[model samples]
Target chain A: MPEQPVPRTGASGVIHDLGYRPYDGPRNGSGTIASALFLSGFRNAFGLGRSGKSKVLPFLLLALNLLPAVIIVGAMTLFNANELPLGYARYASATQILVSIFVAAQAPVLFSRDLRHGSIALYLARPLSSAAYAVARWAALLAATLVFLLVPIVALYVGAVLAELDFSEQTEEAAKAALLAVLLALMLTGISGLIASVSVRRGFAVVATIAVLLLGNGVVTAVQGISDEQGELRVGEVAGLFSPYSLYRGGTSALTDELFLTPPTGAVMTAAYFAVMVLVGIAGLAGIVLRYRRIAGR
Target chain B: MEQVIRTRGLTKDYGSVLALDDLSLDIGPGITGLVGANGAGKSTLIKVLLGLVPPSSGEATVLGLDVIRDAAAIRARVGYLPEHDCLPPDVSASDFVVHLGMMSGLPRVAARERAAEVLRHVGLAEERYRPMGGYSTGMKQRAKLAQALAHDPRLVLLDEPTNGLDPAARDDMLGLVQRVGQDFGFSVLVTSHLLGELERVSDNVVILDSGRLLRASQTRDFLDATGTLLVEVIGADAQTRMGHALAAAGVPVQARGGLLALDPAPELGLDVHDLIRDTAFDLGVGLVRIQADHRRIEDVFADA
Candidate 1:
């Protein structure tokens, strides 16, 4: 065999022998690669590894998402109301618009940039399988959105605690809020990630996501406004099952109505609400995974 | 005798447009340059090998692993530098490369170390921290190359790596590719549209035209020697005088503008080269240079 230019030290400085060395080291499997993508996608969502300009929108939106809870909690402190001024689950519903905007604006940063610039090739050309890549990215977006949604709930919980509210109920509400917020983030990231994956233009993806999310609210409200059954609107309640905010509220209302001043709704409505929420969340996530698999193949 | 990459009846179609047409190749280990014109399916071939795109109707293996059955396994071992611009502009080269390193299954410490090593190897020592958005085209290309090498792939597929560089940077990139193959001992399949650019670095050259294999041969073989010699002698009207003398001495000679072509029959055994030297010495025409007439890579197009 001809002498290869593998590195061998001489008496003097090393010669022009080797520019790169073959890695005999153990290659981490798909799990590590998937975790890496998860970390990268998570950082990208918050613009951590990106430029200062790219950092602006997500941070601003996060601050805005938490602002309402801060203010309401602060007001509760000022009022000296012994009972918790605002409920945990209600915070998600009340600030759903902020969460929606955050998901819409940031999902593009996480998903569309890779598709638009063709950087998906870089991610796919590794140990990570296409499904792993998709799932990791979805996990990142879900986690990021959860952070956006949960921080405010925590702030509200802390504020309510500081306001001298009963501790036991607050803990339960906080736990419920955490669970429902996670569920809500999963649903939003699923739909938004799917949309952003396909839309090559970042602007178009942002608009499309906002439109889809906000349109849910508009459609749910309009359906509620138009359909009145005798004295109550079962159609409105059923339509509320379609919107994430309503589904979450409806599900949480089934377990406890501390967040809502009114009584818990019927068990039949609760079952349908919980069923549809979990179903759509799961189906949407599967669709997103399959979408990325197809995209990676392309 | 082990083929680094082998494909049989490989075909790919993007909907109605066919990118590869029954292409088959068995490339050995070395710097093999994939040369073709625009839309000649060079990029598609790399994509197929890397399993980025599946073959519509064929079979292929890279590093001896089946393309379809072991795509993830193949990708884990092969690095890809895509043809078009694919770098994320906002991320700094260091951070981007480190992240890509981890994606290739390197531990965080290993990834960071590899990122720095590759960035330095690609000549981006200090400026690797700057955002790629602020980088020039050449810088972006270097950064892209760094990421491809960051994982220490056994083989790297570089598609049009010097696409937008000026002459100097192009030469630099070609030199780096040569080093990667020779010094690093990694198999390289670097693609380019310009046939001439691969002449120096490529041990083997594969030329594709219109989605079909036009030529596949060793670079040295591709440059077929005409069994002729380019003879140039000093002094005015020297080529004419030498040609006449060579012909009179029973040698077949042709004047090539200012030079003389000495293509002699081997069966003659007349020692024509020595005879010409002696004759030139006698005439005092001063043989300036005598070299084998080699085929230029551009000559391939003339066949088409």
Candidate 2:
């Protein structure tokens, strides 16, 4: 016996006959982990890796500044000396310069891509909030920068210990160096992430980030130079509070004279400067996140 | 069934240009085709419903959640496939979908499982692990569809799902969309400028013209059968002579190509089929076909 032919219906008729069902299930922790992993994979797919082209220039800039530190470490070990080599202060300055460049270049692209490509809609569609998204991207930036900074620091630390130097002071110095690296990474990452979130265009974001980081200190320095003939220690400390670069200089100067510009008069002043700079960075980042949420909510 | 979307005077402006002008609409469950040409406010409506853009005026709710006040709540249960190609090209379809599922508050294992299930449903099982950059256009669309489904939302807003696809691919995408609404039981608000295409898959269609609501009705109402007949006959001059004979037999006729179009009035005691058959028999012409001409939505606006 032959099978019966199916009856024909209008286009809408076939859809009605299908009897499709909606999906209903529990959303739990497993979902969040999967989503973060997916976002990470997506970022990596777009050539956002540590060694990708987007990061090559910044990495090279960092490597150039760290080269002198590498040589100074070798020289100190060869001479069996406790002090850093000549011009090590300038090398530290170079490290700060490289960090500024890195932050300026990366912040805009990280924040603007979603807005430019219309992927922000897809992102907001998920259970994620703008604050969470901002935090995740900032964390990624900080982690990447830490790898760049820590690799050279670790090489120098191990080289110093292997030289059979005074064991007691060496451990303390190493811990200081690690703490300094964390402070620098956090300062740069937070500032850049905040500025990047201010706009949807990469070029504008980079310009704004750079202007804030570089020009902000210049304005403070000029104000101090004209107002105080005595190079007051308090003014320098106050300036450091306004800028991450200044704060980093003040912090590192306490550990090594190569940080240039004399250290703060007291530990309290240094701590206050560090606290204020970090707070400012956080506030800037928070403002950007709020603005992004407003624009994206549309 | 509950209404999936409801909007009142929803408006949006881009600088001075009003993208969505005082639009109000209600869309129920199942497939609704939001039909409009490019720049005709279709995308604006979808964006407003998804809570991605703030409306300049008015209010809206999706799944009974206020679009502005409950944006996060609305987003939690709504899925969206944007019109543009925004997928990260370097990521595999499975990984991307899984990540999105997790971001939507799913557990890791469950997100992975749901990702696989959605990819398979969209016919991307074999290539699910390959980078989306290497996938074909059809595959990319499927990957986008998979991500939207991975979270198991109550409704999915698909903007121009068939935008760049060829006829065969368009048909395939349309089929998947219909199945998504049917098999998954998710309400679908899909958009397109092609009236004929959506007529095939949409249960209801809302037409927008120049940022204004033109019409909204069930698909059948827009595609109602007109009381007119299209009669075709064989042999040379068949339409010309048939037109005269239909007139002599007191039947309204107009010659259109090889067919004589007749306006059938029920009270006139006119049997359109018999009039054509008997007229053809008398004229010694072979009757080829007789069919009713259904008026399409496009025809309703042709004069305008």
Number of the top candidate by TM-score? Answer: 1
Shift in Å, residue B139, candidate 1 = 2.5
Write model 1 residue lDDT over B139-237, tens digit each, in one string.
Answer: 888998999998898899999999999999999999888988898788999999999989999999999987899999999987899788888898657
Instruction: Estimate, for each residue in B114-231, the C-alpha lDDT of model 2 and write its tens digit.
Output: 8888887888977888777788889988988988888888999999999899899999999999988887888999999888888888899999988888888899998888878998
Clashing pairs in 1: none
True contacts kept of 1: 0.77
Candidate 2's error at A183, in angstroms? 3.6
Every prediction: chain A TM-score? 0.88, 0.75
Q: For model 1 chain B, give the 10-residue run with minimal summed lDDT.
A: B264-273
- RMSD versus native structure for model 1: 4.8
